[model samples]
Target: MRNRLVAGALCGTLAVAGFTGCGIPERSEVRVDGRRQPATESGAVNAWRKEPPPRSMSGTDPEEFVRNFLSAAAGEPDRAYYRVKQFIAQEDDHRLQEKQGSEVELTVVRLVDKPVITPDIDSTRVTIAVQQVGVLRTDGKLAPPVSTDTRYEFGLRSASPAGSVDDGAGFYVIDPPNVLLLSDVALRDYYESQTIYFWNSERTRLVPDLRYLPLTVPNERRLNEVVKWLVGGPSDWLRPGVVGLPDRTELINNATGGNGRWEVNLDMSGDDRTRADQLLTQIAWSLPEFDGQLELKVRNNSVLTEDLGERRSARALYQGLDAPVRYCVYEGSIHPLGIAGESPGAVPLDPGANRNVVSAGFTRADKQVFAALVTASAGRQRLSVGTGPAPVTTFTKGPEHTAIGRPVWLRATDPHQPQGLVVADGRLYRFDQNARMSQIVLNLPPGSVTAVAASLDGRRIALIAGGALYVAALNLDGGTVAVGPPRRVATSLTSLSAVDWGDEERLIVAGAAGRPAIYEISVDGALQTPLKDDTGARVTHLTAFPTNPATKLPSGAFMYEANNVSYRSSPVERIQREQVLDVTPPPTGVRPGSPSAPFFLF
Candidate 1:
């Protein structure tokens, strides 16, 4: 029951059309009959377009036909993948019948080399070497490879006399692999990425789980497909920290609506009426494109919630931090970041005389307060918090010069009492508005936390431990900080240096697989999209403004620092190196001229 189009809405005709999932543009559409309709006709109902179904090439070499068959298998999901049978032996065609509903579950692999063909007297053997990429659990959710070793072999023979009677007969595959095989490209072209919403373990907030719905689904059935998947549950990787609808919850009928309005009716007979609000909130957040209402009914024709059966636009029901402003610490002072034009005035935190700042963060509650990690002695550092120009309140100190990570503010709804988190001596601690500090225990090896970033909503925390990425649910129940078991993600990145939330479902991370670069990874680890960063220097730090859902644009700039120089990037501006920031009052006496660690106040 959401009216506003947040993050991902329908493409082209945002208001009239249904959700298209991700921001990627729709592929060219072809009618279901595999032909284009004449543009000269006027009709009451608009014609539909989908990717043309794959067809086998005629009069082609057996090896060539094998290639075509492989390509055809990966195209639009035809009924039982019947389209691929055109190139299979009529006797072996029945093999695919068992593969129904498995088109989206097919294994995706990257071709390591060309297919090797071994010819025999009556048949040819095709051996393909491949590296497993992942598996398509749904249209949008690609589970990580189950094992490191994934290869396949196929057999083909000249068409039988009965098969040759057909038009331009080519060789038919003999015994093909029992499971379906698809290339990485086909996985991308056929599936549309959609995010499903789930509640945190505490049931206090909704977390996004990115899943895919195949583009092959007709517009009329897309809503039902999404709703069914939502009721089924969240992906396995995200299950550790999130909860889905009640067990056995079922859709009573197809989601019905039109003209930009829709309604979903769910059967929640076994569900507790007290939890109806939480269930409805999850549904509202998941279906941002359905700008109408939702109804939950029991089996006996009774409403699930006697007083709260109807739900209208829930856009504001679950919102995270909105548009952020970026700031930089220079020469013991904080200044608003400016790529061009005159820089804004510095925040008057008063870092105290002769104190060298290591890192810092700022937040606004009842009043503006700044936190910093500053050099306490020749080889030691201490964390502090204070208001403008007031005497700084020190929180924790590190022993033996152990480097302290930068301070990050958790979302504090109360204007008077803000909370921030920092890492020192390999232990995580939280600071409350009254400057009370408490350690947040994690189920990991001690001293493994290298860095941490709190999600804008303040319910989730992403951290790097032992050079690996992990995200955990943050439960602030009864004023005591408790962290749920941390779930490891982004395993593809062998080493991680920094991480930050790009949005609810995606994290902007700086890590290395083979080469060093920046990547946007879905929180579930199903998808990893690399951003353009050609800078040879390794990214040691990253600061991002969570994307604004209303405009589908970042509210502020995203800046990162590498090689001691800070660079700025945004939707309006491509990644570009910026000149060294000019310090306010220009530090004297051989100070480091390059600005480092610029961040946005969450």
Candidate 2:
């Protein structure tokens, strides 16, 4: 899809992350095209010499040259590559092109101070350290916002002594050119994020992976690039457990579309014709953003799909897989939300549940809801299971421990019921049917974890610890699994109240530091587009998806408290409902925080 439609297109562009210096990749020949110089009459060898391009920096001042190198390098990948090379010696012309893939557009967020340049022999050791934002790493993960410093080796040459010539007369060059450093705000404006959706063997989930691309492409070229990247397959980190595009296939011509229909022609002679259906399926799942129907052709010959007769949206493969099975509560009750919100989407539960449960969760398998319950207002908290009814089963009763927030349920496809995760007394614990004892998942400093939510795929978890949002890789094996170091979701969001998977890779976040607005932020921190229609009020609670979890429509509903009254509203349609489905408002006096009040779907 085009950058305009990207839900999490953070800022005018998306975000980037950490930066530490690494030597530029080895040099390769720079391709000089015919367009570089204008053509003159064939036989006439004119007496003309090409003028040197304006210098980014002109002088013996090595420090300013370092700054100029960065300014020149922060541009369209190729243009910047060539511009930065002018600062290096002629011998290192290919370093930028060879080291950074030709297609990569660099977004360098500079958070560094003045450089310290020390002259040594013919070489000047220029140490340029910076706190980088929006930095992309080789492993396909965004770096966290932190100051990581490195030095650049820039060799210099001089034509005269200090008093012999003008200050701008001598020479200062960023020696190898490969170790160029840069910093600027506008770098992000030229980049936008694109997503490629892939699925597991069961097709139970569509994993959205993000890729940052330049906005230089036009609509047609953008569409063509999307097709090319989709067929190119997902990033290495997300490659495991997800399907890959068929081998030996490539796009022979361009992809063209009109009136919401797209024509994709591919070269198919290499091999594996048996996987035609899989290839088409991949394309089908990807075209919804364009509001498109695809007509795929192999070598300009149409591949008919009418015979199979089973057409599915990429989303269709993952329906009901991550549906919130039960409504979450902050007070002492559990209500069944089921797969569809229709099972009951309001507050103030009916006569079936216990009154002591403060937080709750349930499985996709059944109505059975599990919760953290306090026997009394002053009693110890314990884990209990019930079917939204009284006389709940006491599963795990621990010491007088303080529960952080609500308990989250992760429903595995296993024969057993859904798994439960809760944080108490600064320790994260998990619960199951046969095991009544608490198994710690991860431990943190007291009050560090502000909020927690997991992706639908169940392999990753999102946390708001230490007042910042982060997505941590999760390994949920019988609890010995580890939680990898976190990648902060947004370097800008310092105060986030809640987070839920908007799609596989994007998250709908509320309470972005100081704003009343909500943002469609990517899990990798690359994109953060504001939800189009304003929430009409300070957004206090958010449900990631629509009432129908299977539906592809982004959720327009949110809960906010105003004028001392809580109301559920859809700012998109400008609809405000005083009552939230069947659930009644808090009984007379008890008021759960908006974060605690919004009904959580499984």
Candidate 3:
């Protein structure tokens, strides 16, 4: 459950780190006045409106000039510098203009305070506060409002026209502050976000490249902008794993959609002729958010594919980041659970088999099970990957830390033989049983890793280091996994002990729940809606049904010890007590009993 809508919930609508999975807005329809319009796209849900020209600052008050300047700053992305120049002194204009490339994008901002104007005989200094909403960076990323208290020093020249002794409307910029201040809010009434489609490296699936473009223009115009950005390619960060298959192909005109039909007019440039269906497929997939069919047109060209119906929707054609099963440690052994509620749901993994297995790892895609096994010969822990009663291949002979997080299986180029990732001694290891074992060095806080989880797409990985959550994009360098600078998942969370991907967008986390005693969190490190209040339960290990996304995670397998009994349940069903063995010993100050380590869907 997520927090309900409230004031100061400006960042609530901010897109989660990835638009490819759980954060993708479910299909929604829009109303154009009384009549219905196509399903509204993200960020573009604001009511359709003509982009009015920037207000004239020629004779306006200082506050009005400031207000108008904010519009100018964002109204044109390519001309942000000149627009800000309109509100700055001529002397300072050249500086802001030349440094435009370094400028950050800020569109929806609020005037935080009443302007404090101190008029002098020759000039005036007006100080004001501003907050911008949903900041759009020049690099094309969206973040919540920051630095709301930023003070912009604006130098005002009140040279009276005709020397009328009245400042009147003759006020212009004398000196202007260099930094822009802004805050973000839920402005579905004024803005919309859109998903630009791109092809995964395999060209088998289309991943989304999301952008928050201004809704100041008509929906079709905004769609044209989306198409252009799509053609340009994925963002700098997402480009490593995805390519724009339909990108580089020009749209002859703005795309138009209505009444379940969309028209995509193309220029047929740069291999467009050879890959027309690919372009149509990308368009079909991206546009179906409106529940519409696609009609592609190339000017003066004969009808190539007459029924350019939408070939796919990004959702259905795309099987998001998981296999369709879940595995749990029930009754001291690995067991399987149906993701879509399948048959033989809670069967013991290797019935009657004696093993030194502590925490087992099984991928949802297939039953290629791996576990942290105690090596009898060396008395050290190693990752073992196998199919049946006995281990076949060893992943690591660890000299690492004593505690290890559950390993995960990711789809490999071979599809049948997926690779694995695990954490030990605060270091990440990526290995294939038959191949190489390499350390995934990341620039993160130093400490033994308590938990690790990978996204279904194999593009990002999340880890808990020193009780804080960090996420990083994955890159393949030659033959090993490389992590980019990890992005801190900071929010209201404190003392995070365990984490798992609940869905594509959120993470199911446990710490010390809410203010009233509940513990749940999203991937962004914000509080999730509590499942149940005051169960007096402390979750030590958590796992989700991989097929049915754990977005709300109200139901899932978790082990919590209450009164010396380790009980594992779906958090909503009858509890089944398991023998207490070795719990990961909840990070120093906390106490609970359960051998329940991180479990997964096999």
Best by lDDT: 1
Decide which is better by TM-score, 1 or 3.
1
Residue 19 displacement in candidate 2 (angstroms): 39
Q: Pick the candidate with the highest TM-score.
A: 1
| Per-residue lDDT of 482 in model 2 | 47
What TM-score, computed on C-alpha atoms, does each candidate reach? Answer: 0.72, 0.58, 0.62
In candidate 3, what are the lDDT values of residues 1-602, reduced to their tens digit?
A: 11111112222221111111233322221221112245555345436542313435446466665555545554335665665665665555654524445365553444446667787777788776554333566534454445444456666776456457674545556666554432232222223444456665656555544454444554555445656666666655466666664434676756766555556677655554646666666665554444545566666363344333334423344343332333445334454432223332333334434255556655433334434332222444555554332333334444434555566755433345456777765677775644244777667657766667765556556677777777665654443566666655543345555566644444555555343122333333322334333335554445543222223223233333333233333333323322222223356776533333434443
lDDT of 2 by residue, 9-65 (tens): 323422211111231211221211111112122222213222223343456666666
lDDT of 3 at 230: 65
- Ranking by TM-score, best first? 1, 3, 2
lDDT of 1 at 203: 70
Ranking 1 against 2 by lDDT, winner: 1
